[model samples]
Target: DFRPHDEHYVQNFVLVTHGLLMRIFCMCYFRWTVLEFDQVWNPQNCEIWVLEKTKKGRYRLAGSWQEESKSFGPIKFGADKTKLLYPHMKESTPARDMVPGKPGWLDDPALRHLVVAAQFGKGIGVNKELGSLG
Candidate 1:
């Protein structure tokens, strides 16, 4: 069963997905921003982590997620603080055509093919109980 807070987790996952997309496949012009939200029931329970892709083709945690209860920063989580980083668009493409924008092609099922094509196989990390799964 999904908890009441599951929706927040799902939204976080969507943000992570967009971040991965911008980092790997999208052109360098695109910028990504992730803003986490705390559950209303618990003010101190929320977090926002922002990952930015540098010019050198590497992802970096742009800033700390932890902040005072109502502190302001590049990324904020609230009803009024929803302006994440603006995504980049190609020279010929209009700003409205960018991914995650209103009515963009990223929602198409055909994009699933692109995602599968870009996926790397699972890694061979050591398992605590089963030991090496490789």
Candidate 2:
């Protein structure tokens, strides 16, 4: 089952995605601002720990997904949160015609197809029984 998405989580993911796209892929020419002003994330339950697989397909801590290739996580918060980083992120070619921008952008139906791409792979686990700082 899918985790119930918190809007806070979704919004911040957009911020990270946009930032990554800008610095790495140059898909956008805009600044870090979500719309007009920047969206300052809250540093509570939003801490993100990136988990990656090795070349041999073994699970390993990737240190950080790296917000625009900058060092700041394994567990990130506030301006660094990024739990949803997934496949093709570095290679995500934003459709020139369908980048996010609308009254209710998160609820946009056209981009719904991107949801699976953002989901954590089946390898990710939670709790001590699985793997977590807790």
Candidate 3:
């Protein structure tokens, strides 16, 4: 649920299942569809995606810079003004965590790449479970 105005609208992101810890990150990209989407949000509408590309799932809504990622301390996006690194941001806090409306460059792949690279410090570590987002 990463949608700002509509909290319970957007569904599915990252599902990290390491050993017994199955963490759900709404910032990560989807590995696929159907099962994963339903697991994230039961009775999810395939007609509604995240921000843009409704049928496309906005797969990489967060950012894609985890191709060559490394290990880091406990993941936490502390004191991030734009909440670029914040975990489960859009779902955590609507007013603070997310931008009011969709920006013009949101769908731009090149600009998106730059933004994602700048925000993610060490890059996404759970790219295995989540899609590459490239």
Candidate 4:
């Protein structure tokens, strides 16, 4: 059983496979327009949370999963709203990529590898989660 974001509107993802296995991931993006310009910036990130199933058949957040790499750097959830400390965030956060355009998960080699491994282990199809996100 898979719960789509639109249907739940909770800005969360619940993926259940092979009956007993359940994985929860959270992805969110938002944009804001400033002044009279039509231009807007969208930042997005995916959060893989540790979900524990309750006796009542409900899921609860335990914590989040973080991956750190000395070769590359610490994996990020993407440019968050806090990055908007200035009117021109593009200049301030040149290192961070905006979401809906650059998915950090797909861009980072380590993150990509983790996703692929999870998919393979769970017997999930290719880009199934990506399609849902997009």
lDDT of each: 0.32, 0.32, 0.30, 0.30
Q: What lDDT tens digits, residue by residue, belong to model 3 across residues 8-100?
A: 665444433331122233423322221122223211222122222444444323332233353222222222323333333223222222121
Clashing pairs in 4: none
lDDT of 2 by residue, 27-121 (tens): 13211222111212233333343434355533343434455766645323122355432222222233534334333333434333233321332
Task: Give the lDDT of residue 38 in candidate 2.
Answer: 20
Instruction: Please tell me which model should have the higher TM-score, number 2 or number 3.
Output: 2
Error of 3 at 33 (Å): 14
Candidate 4: list runs displaced more than 4 Å: 1-44, 68-134
User: Taking the candidates one at a time, how many backbone clashes does each contain?
Assistant: 2, 0, 0, 0
CA shift of 83, model 4, Å: 17
Model 3 residue 43 CA deviation in Å: 29
- Candidate 1: misplaced stretches above 4 Å? 1-45, 62-64, 69-131
Q: Please give the RMSD to the true structure for each candidate, in Å.
A: 18.3, 19.0, 16.7, 18.3
lDDT tens per residue, model 4, 1-134 = 54544564454456534211221112211111111011112212443434455565454434335545212211122123121122221111123232433444346432243334333233432253562221
lDDT of 2: 0.32
Error of 3 at 109 (Å): 16
- lDDT of prediction 1: 0.32
For candidate 3, the lDDT comes to 0.30
Model 4 C-alpha lDDT versus the unseen true structure: 0.30
lDDT of 4 at 8: 44
User: What's the TM for model 2?
Assistant: 0.21
Residue 73 local lDDT, model 1: 44
Candidate 3 colliding pairs: none
